[model samples]
Target: MTYRGRFAPTPSGDLHRGSLLTAVASYLDARQADGAWHLRIDDIDPPREVPGAADRIQQQLAAHALHWDGSVQYQSQRHDAYAAAVDMLLASGHAFYCALSRRQLADLGGRHPGPAVAVSPASHSATNTNPNPNTDCAIRLAVPDTPICFTDRLQGRQCLSLGEADGAFVIRRRDKLYAYQLACALDDADQGMTHILRGADLMDSTLRQVHVLDCLGRTRPDYGHLPVLTDSDGNKLSKSAGAAALSPDTSANLYGALRLLALDPPADLAGAPCAEQLAWAIPQWQPARLNNTLTFGVADAP
Candidate 1:
């Protein structure tokens, strides 16, 4: 199969140092393999997306010369596709509606560590009067009671016991938005993405996605979850923490992000033009140079 990779961004804010690293890693890997690199803007959750953030993200990525191939894809425009997939799964008996309340799951002796959220197979409630899946009512994949395992391209062989982590999980939401596990699998398959480059924070989600793909009878793609960039205080650079947005005028932030991921860019990069620096850095991308740890703090950067 052709090597196809992608940099999927959720436009909740501008690209942060951490996000740039992810974009850089994916971009370089695709280029190195002479593969296609696609861009997908995950804007399905409009309620969470920030105003003008998507446009600003595109502008910043262009400024840094992290160009992508083909037309950009926006998830909001693909709701019908997600709906169709959900319907197919429902009809095929590979998925079913779940009605577990947050409070009940929360009290499940404690939150399950991995991705699968356990719901009793015998515990489902679908009334004729309220047939619509609730945002709280999610579609859970009916994964076989087996071990979900994969060899991480960067971290090596790994395994997650579905029964231990999270049991079957939500594929569709009560709120009508398709769940991430479901939507991502369908989108990746449709986009012909064979290599997935994302952050280690999503490791748990990977097992969940793999489980969902298995149930849907789809191919599981190769994955490389890079080290997560953390804040000065050691918290991961998440939107909730307001990671500093990328500035078109500065490659310092972007370079710092690469460093945080342990990419040893050329020494002259600090003064080189952003385009020149990126041109030099892309081919030098090395996934093995990065530590297998889940997170990286600013202090960790050289």
Candidate 2:
């Protein structure tokens, strides 16, 4: 099958060096395989989104010559699809309404306080017997005791026991917003994505997504997590951490991102154009070279 990959970025801020690294890695992987690469704007949470961040992100990618395969998809406009997924999970007895508040769940320990079981949707109304009459309900997936395991192309074998902390994970928030875990899983399946290339900072989320895919009876895509860029203090570089936005100099930024990925480019290519640099680096983009490394330091320039 032809490999299909995506770079889904939240429109909370402009593209930082860390974000650029992930985008470049995903772009190279898809191009190397002669597969289609897609761009997805994860703009579900309106309150957190910046006004023009999504457009800026697209401009940055274009500046670097990393164009997408087709029209970009925005999660905010795909609510109908996400809703259908939730309905399907509920009907199949994989998820149910949860009236438990965050405080109540925390009091019972952050993880699932009770035994894990397959709960029917009918049980949602029966189990929620709180007398306060003021609690909103969120949708949660029933996690089993079985381990969720997948062999990441870069990280190798990995496993997570969903029953540990918070036995059941929320797929929809009490405020009626769809959770990232649910929306992302459904989008990937719907878009026919065959591979996921992202940063190691999201490594833990892999299991939760796999569980969602299993519940929906969909095929789980292959995953590859590249090393996360970190600040001098060892914290992961992120929009939350206030990482500086990348400059529009595509050649320099591309070189810098490639260096972070441990893909050493020729010294002479430092002054080359973005497209030329990418052309030279595509054949040398060996993901295996990033094996076992989870984080790397950011440099001053490309």
Tens digit of lDDT per residue, candidate 2, span 1-302? 99999999999999998899999999999999999999999998888898999999999999998989999999999999988999998799888776665556665567643323222233332243432213466778888888889999999998888888458888888788999999998899999999999999887788899999999999999998888888888888888678889886778888888887778888888879899989988888999999998988645334
Which pairs, if any, clash in model 1? Answer: 116-166, 116-167, 133-174, 134-137, 134-174, 135-174, 135-175, 139-171
Model 1, span 238-278: residue lDDT tens:
77688777665667766776666566776778766677777
TM-score of each: 0.87, 0.92
Worst 10 residues of 1 by lDDT: 109-118
Sequence-dependent TM-score of model 1? 0.87
Q: Which predicted model would earn the best TM-score?
A: 2
Report the error of model 1 at residue 24, Å: 0.7
C-alpha lDDT values of all predictions: 0.76, 0.84
Off by over 4 Å in 1: 107-137
